[model samples]
Target: MASLGVFISCTSDAKKTNDKAKTVTAAGDTVATPEAEVGTVREPVDTAKYDALVKKMANGDTTGNWAGRKGPYPLAGAILPFKRIVVYYGNLHSKKMGALGEYAPKEMWSRLNQEVKHWEKADPSTPVQPGVHYIASVASGTPGTDGMYINRMGDKQIDSVLKIAKMQNAIVFLDIQVGLSTIQKELPRLEKYLKLPHVHLGIDPEFSMKDGSKPGKKIGTYDAADINYCSDFLAKLVRANNLPPKVFVVHRFTRKMVTNYKNIKLRPEVQVVMHMDGWGEPDLKIGTYRHFIFPEPVQFTGFKLFYKNDLKKAPNRLMTPEDLLKLKPVPMYIQYQ
Candidate 1:
């Protein structure tokens, strides 16, 4: 379950726009195309040189300045130099959620690689980090026998995403949408997965039933206390396992999706990202980011793209990688649904 903007339009204009663009994919397949033309056109990047630079940076060679910033924030043990992270979000079996779930797993990975490569070419200095974000706990309309309005995905389902993430050499995020369930009740169930070095966590406030209403009846909220609780939880795990700092993302588009922003604390072992998850035309999205996400700062920031919902309006255009990169405090994490 997500904000009302997420469910707005269901037109196939995005596909029509894709056809008109006739853009080629990195894998040599002409799949969905980029929405806008990038301004900078340069010689094809010397990837071998790029890879060598990456290796040097990994070895603690910090002589040259890199584009964007090598994170002071550590994800998966390495201080990733690039600020761009392109993530595909959804479950393999669900249709209501997104395009990540619309295709088979292998096909999905192929598409994800295409986006990753697109960002790599668009901003040669900031190589995109690929990730798979699975909605592990779905919000339910009815409270279950345990009185929790969240339905946890089976272990096999979680493992499937993990396996695919490993195939891409990418990180994995288990997203939670707590309906009536408290974070205390739902978070521990994913501890086994969280223990894995590459696995991170995401929480959606849209379905958080703070007032005992159903999941989709009204927009929900999570205060700073709740965020602090989750960060403390992850910090413990990071220290206990000697793993890198965990990436904790909170999904928001509306101001109310997350409350008491001033009080949200940061931890050495946890990187908090305030992700903009609203869907609409390009201008609306930028405005949403500017008003809701930009002014309120966090450890890091993320933006989400909805394959279908983003194109619901007629005469609409999607935001290109370059377009999003231009945002103030440019989003470090990018998710596609």
Candidate 2:
């Protein structure tokens, strides 16, 4: 079952308009230009607390980390609030040849590689390039799954993704199902790919159930311990490679997906983002962000607009150039079909 909590200040509808610019309507209420609503800048986050959190993670300590932090906005840095043009490259199975379970053929691989290259080269003036996050398949080689039985396409898949990242200098997100393995256990295997400067991590908590749990069950819950394990490992790996702090992406559709989520201690050096993957209408997208996302301390947030699914339901409300601009804490990443 899903749970809801009210922790942050609700956004008011009182339009704060500028004398110079035109007003706009967002979330059913007319609002002034974004610049007019800039209230007292939120105080800078306490760096001392952030420093202590990093030390605790490095030492494998999870205690007291959750005690000090509060709900909603725990950290700060709105300089580049997330934008809404992010694209999520999910479903590698669709890129495979023949039957759904068939191995991804060389032809399919080449085609996908070329397509990604094109996206990388997309004009920067267009909000499509450099911001695309390619999600690698986590269920590819797992036994008993539809994608299993094929030769393990481990580094081969990683290599293809890296090529796009290097070509566009874009961020590459490694998606992990963690079906049967713990995050720690899977880290070493992915070290070769993770060491790349552009690579980041995406955890599919839906498939991170403990042993004996059924698939599609409400199984994965990221507690302080789990987050510490992830942060510490990635921090060390990134430092060893002399790369910038790694981005850790967590997916959540309902509240239960990330129990005690607000308490997860993260390193300041590492960028952590919680993405709401509730796919459906554009209005649903707006509501989700206003109700669930505006409260979180995520460094960035993502929105997925289905080229086919979205067009089928509310063809008129499909996200447009102007609609994309109004997303609060502008979406850092936008996903397409």
Candidate 3:
């Protein structure tokens, strides 16, 4: 559960749009060759680099839990220890949701780039990859017509986020807050966007409310079965489309958020990141990561820093990249809200 406070205000229309994303057309209005068909760019893994990455991922883990020996080497084009992902996370409709929607696109990208540079400088060895994590399905307070307390963002909104991310060639992660809905229902509708090469995925167990409880009433949970379903879904996409491996991020702050960690299967076509997403002072946040995240061995690790919620208490400051680099199994994916 999140030791947190952030209003998840969602106002986007649930109806999806029919227009093609910017990627589908050229300036002359000519239909471009789809990325999925043209992308046969899976590079074979190098053993030496893989070993070094495993070492960096371990970050001096005496327990030998990290650099998990799960599945297989990430299929070609996986972005992880080779490149640190720095992302702005939020919804475009509500400033309360996160930094991605709190500022203008220009201002947000500028601020995002600053942190990207910080990570780049802090760990000169691992370059930073910029990204935008948009909340595609926001858990809501009231159940809509579908009886699910969630507002789903249509293609138009997702396209706007894509345009912003393209500014820096940043990757995009569509985050889902399932509310009363299940992953089976939510993920398929967004397949058009997920099929895009530059786009990835994030599933928040924080808002997964599986027990018919309203969102924000209680923290929710996702069993390893839920996670395997998502990973399997992505792996099939990779094989069918011949696209590179996709990065799959799962948010967690408490052990209950993600149960049966060992049973969450992995694949070469998908890289799983168990992201620590609680908000509090530095000490509390660190403790949350150590207790809930570090102990369980996931494929890769991610850390989320709330720009506002994190500094509400003493030691009123954000965790700098330098400060975070000290963490065991240093986070390969860093998100700012």
Off by over 4 Å in 1: 1-83
- List model 3 lDDT by residue over 1-337, tens digit each: 2321233433321233344334452122322222222534445777578778878778788887875454688877777657888999988888777888889999998999898888878889898888999998888877889988888887778878877877777788998889999998999988867777778999999888899998998999999999999999999987776667899999999999999999989898999999989888888889999999989887888999987888888767888988888888888899998
TM-score of candidate 3 against the unseen true structure: 0.90
Candidate 3 weakest lDDT stretch, 10 residues: 25-34
* TM-score, one value per model: 0.78, 0.59, 0.90
lDDT agreement of model 2 with the native: 0.47
Taking all chains together, the TM-score of candidate 1 against the true structure is 0.78
lDDT of 3 at 228: 94
> lDDT tens string, model 2, 113-181?
443354334422222333334434343222444322112235555555454444334556676655555
For each candidate in the order shown, give its overall lDDT on alpha carbons. Answer: 0.70, 0.47, 0.81
lDDT of 1 by residue, 1-337 (tens): 2532222221011111222223232234332212121221223334455444444322242333222233333433432333456788886656667656768878888988988888888778776668889888878766667777667788767776766776666778899888888887789988877866667899999888899987888899999999999998999987776566677889998998889988987776787888998889999899998788767766567889887788899877777888876766567788998
Candidate order (TM-score): 3, 1, 2
Candidate 2 ranges beyond 4 A from true positions: 1-88, 91-93, 96-137, 140-153, 217-220, 312-317
Q: Which residue pairs show backbone clashes in model 1?
A: none
